[model samples]
Structure formats: C-alpha cells, structure tokens
Target: MDQMMETKKHNTNKGQKLNVQPLRTQTDIETAKFFLSKNKMGKRDLLLFLFGINTGLRASDIVVRKVGEFRNTKKPYIVEEKTHKRRKLNLSNLAEQIDEYIADKSDDDWLFPSYKDRSKHLTVNGVYRMFEVLGKQMGRDDLGTHTMRKTFGYHYYKRTHDIATLMEIFNHSSQQITKRYIGITEDEIDNSLDHFSIGI
Candidate 1:
C-alpha cells in the first residue's frame, strides 16, 4: 500500500497543472454521463455533470449548494463564491431531473453530499477528481471541472451566436475574452484562413 501511495504521489506531483478542455461534442458528453452514472459517482454525479453544463456554475458553487436552494424553485439564485455576485440562474430546463433527485430529501441535505460523510457536501477536490477520472476514461487529457462551464459557454454560443448575452452571462470584461474562453478564437482563425484565397 505504501509503495502504491508513493507512486501515486509521484505521478500527481509530476503534473502540477491540469489542462482541461470543454466537452465539445454531444456524443462525448453522453458517453461521459452514461459511464459516470454506472460508476462510483452514481446519480449525483450525473446531476452535477448535467447541472454544470446547463447552468455554467463553478464546481465550488455547485458543491456547496443545498437541496433547499433547488427545491420548489425554477430560477434559483446564488451568490458566486469567487465573485461574490448574486446572480439569478435559470435551471427550468432540468426541472424534472432536479425535482426527481431532490424528492423525499430534506431541505438541509447537501445536493452533492460526501460519500463518506453525509453531513458535509463533497469537496472541490472530490468533484475535480471525479472529472479527472472520467476524463481519463474518455481519453481526454484536457478534462476537469471547468470543462462543464466551458461546455455550456461553447454550446450556448453555437446555438445563439450571441456573444453579448454570453459575455453578460459569464460576466466577462469583453466579448473577445468570451470568444477566447469558448474557443471561438480558433474558429475565427479557421474561417479567416478558409476565406483567404489568392487569385492566381
């Protein structure tokens, strides 16, 4: 056990920073959801994954949320942990799922409680590890908690083509930042090159 621990510690220390990327394709997202649902994370993990992509809330906020916050509420409001901004979030699309998940549960229960200790919500590292494991399983080295929010931003922008609204949603300083965050910069580069044709 000690040898295994040492090896694990060494491996983790080798990679200080994780390069995480968003779930760009629908199939990848579905596969991840299906895999995690059957694994240790179970239903709660599925909810977290879905909620993250849907609401674009950071894992910190999601981890600390209680059942009461989501119970009997269509537009749940939360004060972001990092920014300390009170933002009204719309999660109506997942109303049925949220309702079913929170059914028969107490208002005080943590929405994503720790598996070992029921009283405490799951830690940020716990959530991050979940994504890391799933990312490895999915053959995506660039996958982590932030992927959820980035996925939401990428898909939302694709569907709406509205950078202004997305900018406001993310509270970004400028549309350029939003564009770069969602990887629109790469797309723009591709489009520009595609249009550049020298008339020979």
Candidate 2:
C-alpha cells in the first residue's frame, strides 16, 4: 500500500478562497504544524511543510524532489526551478525526520507523492491545496504556498538582522526590496518608534 493510503481519512472545506499570504508569526507557524500533525494521513504533507519553511524552496522545486535526496547529508542542495539558481541548505537537523518519513520507501519515491496516483509526484497546485486545507483548518484564510518562503525570510532576517545578506540569499536587487519582501519595514518602524523618547 502507498504511504498516504494507509492513513486515516481527512475531509477538506469547500469553496475556499485562493488569495493567500505568508504564515507570518512563529505562533501561526507552530499552530499550522500542530493541525497538520493531527491528521493521520498527513505525514508527507507535514514534512513538506517543514521542508518548505526551513529551506525556503518554492513549491515548484519542493514537490519534485525524492526522499533519498536528504539522506546522511548536512548540506542538501536544490536547483530552483523558477530562477534556475542552485541553493545549498544546512539542514542537518532535518535528517532524522527525512529518514523516518522515508523509511519504507525506496530512494526513487517522491517525498510528497500524490495520494491518488503514486506514479507521479504531487503538482504545485497540489501543494497549494495542501496549504489551503491547513490554512482553513487554522482559520488562516490568507495562508498560501508562498507562506513557507516568506516565513523563512521573515525569521531569518529577525535572527540575523542582516538585510544585505538576506538580499543576496533572496537574489533581490537592493536592501529596500529585501526589506519589503520580508515585511521588515513595518517592523523596523515599530521598533524605532518603541525606542523613541521626548525627554520624559
């Protein structure tokens, strides 16, 4: 039996809106993880979500990967399907999860294979639908596939506070673009205002 076919069933909401936004906060990310973890048939989807936020890979590149790509490696690399850029990621912590997720599967098996058809990997739209299902479950109607990438960028900037480095990572033309892309402008403004004083 296929890995996804052995798990319990899940029902999805209907007529969901397609407009989506980033996962945004750590709390929101955790909450989404919690919900996904509860679904018995969602192991693959859960891993896909984690890999997305951690590696910041676009859904296109992420959905096409095989389970064996992450074995026994501290630095797993991927070529961005959209920009054709090569990225090497430090994901040693993810090795255990990858190992567990792919235990019974062969090296050639898709990490996130389609539930209905194991012969083909899940499509980008399939990933979008996965996020959409989880988004509605978490009352985050704005959450979309890009949320994973934005979450990575947002938290990366928060931790490093290095826009130039982030700009390079994201391949943006300028710090201004990086700031806006990661929603840092408002954060900077709010942080500065919080430190403002008028001789109190």
Candidate 3:
C-alpha cells in the first residue's frame, strides 16, 4: 500500500498521471453538475462534460468536430477523427437540450469552435481550462479535464465488467494500461477484499 501511494505521488508530481478524484459518489456528481450549471458557463460547460463523459473521448478529438459531423439528426453518430472509427453514441438524453440550445447556431460552425475563428474548433487546452475553472469553482482541487474521461472509463468498466470492451473503447493495446487508466490502484484491491466473505 505504501509503495502504491509513493508510485501515485510520483506519477502525479511528474504529470505522468492525473490525480483525479473519482466521481463515484452521488454527491460528487452533484457537485460537478452544480458548477457546470452555473450561468457564467452556460451550455458550453455542460456540453463539454456531456461530450467527454458520454463519449469517453479525448478532449482533442471532440474540440475539432464541426457541426456537420453531428448535424444529421436522422443518424446521430460521431466519426472519431483520431481512430477514424464512427461512434454511434446515444444522445437521447441531451439531444433535445442541445438542439434547443443551438436552434439558431449554424451547422458550418464548430461544435465548440474558437472565438477567433469559427472555422476552427476549440483547442484541447481551451476545454481543459474551462473544466479547470469549473472544478475550482466547485472547490475540487483534484479535478482536471482528464477526470471526466477517466470517470467515463471507470464507470463504463464498472457497468460492463469487460476489460476487453474497455480496451476497445479506449483503443488501448493492453489490459495493464487499461487497468491503470480505469483507476485500479492498490487501495481498490484492498477494498475488494471486503466483498470476499465466502459463506462457508
């Protein structure tokens, strides 16, 4: 356990790992939702969380997609730019919300385009900063942009309990990397022991 904590500390200090606080509890989710719902951020912040969490996608891939990429209301699917794989994601929950939000917005415009150039989409760093601000506003210092993506990975793994599925979703080549990506720390291992009360 001590060794794992040291490794985690080293990883965090080196920026090699994101020391994210898992949004495991309902209260944590509420906190994230509360800050995101602030009038100052409006729809963009909510959109970022929805996009990141629902898609389990890297911010880089999402920042560049044009409205046309997802404008086809008939077939709502996002073609992943990095993997060249089209993602048929479920949007029923927020589809109406986003449509209402962007009723007057143009399809040629970016989904999260840059202010300087509507032709260009929002940069990863831009989205990162936006999330950082929201996290700070919520007094969650451990929050980072990567937190949402990792949160998605963690929950997806929990729901599916299929590491192969997660590996495919994240495009990871190995379970080892997926394990780390999904927040499999030594503490989690110890916690699992609590569930091992075999009724002999």
Query: Which candidate ranks first by lDDT, i.e. highest?
Result: 1
Clashes per model (N, Cα, C within 3 A): 0, 1, 0
- By lDDT, the better pick of 1 and 2 is 1
In candidate 3, what are the lDDT values of residues 85-145, reduced to their tens digit? 8777666666776676667788777787675676677776666566667667777766665
TM-score of each: 0.86, 0.80, 0.75
Score residue 128 of candidate 2 by CA lDDT.
Answer: 63
lDDT of 3 at 180: 77
lDDT of 1 by residue, 1-200 (tens): 21122234435644412345678899999998997898675989999999999998777889999999988898988999868999998988999999999998999999999999989999867877787788778987777667788899989999999999988888788898888777778777988998688884
Off by over 4 Å in 2: 1-20, 189-200
Q: Which candidate do you rate higher for TM-score, 2 or 3?
A: 2
Which stretches of candidate 1 lie above 4 Å from their native place? 1-18, 190-200
Scored by lDDT, model 2 comes in at 0.73
Q: Give the candidates in order of lDDT, highest first.
A: 1, 2, 3
Looking at candidate 1, the ten consecutive residues that score lowest on lDDT are 1-10
Superpose all Cα atoms of candidate 2 onto the true structure and report the RMSD in Å to 1 decimal.
8.1
* Pairs of residues at least 3 apart in sequence or in different chains that clash in candidate 3: none
Tens digits of lDDT, candidate 2, 58-146? 67788999878876676878887757888898887687888888889988888889888997898867766777788779876766666
Question: Best-fitting candidate, measured by TM-score?
Answer: 1
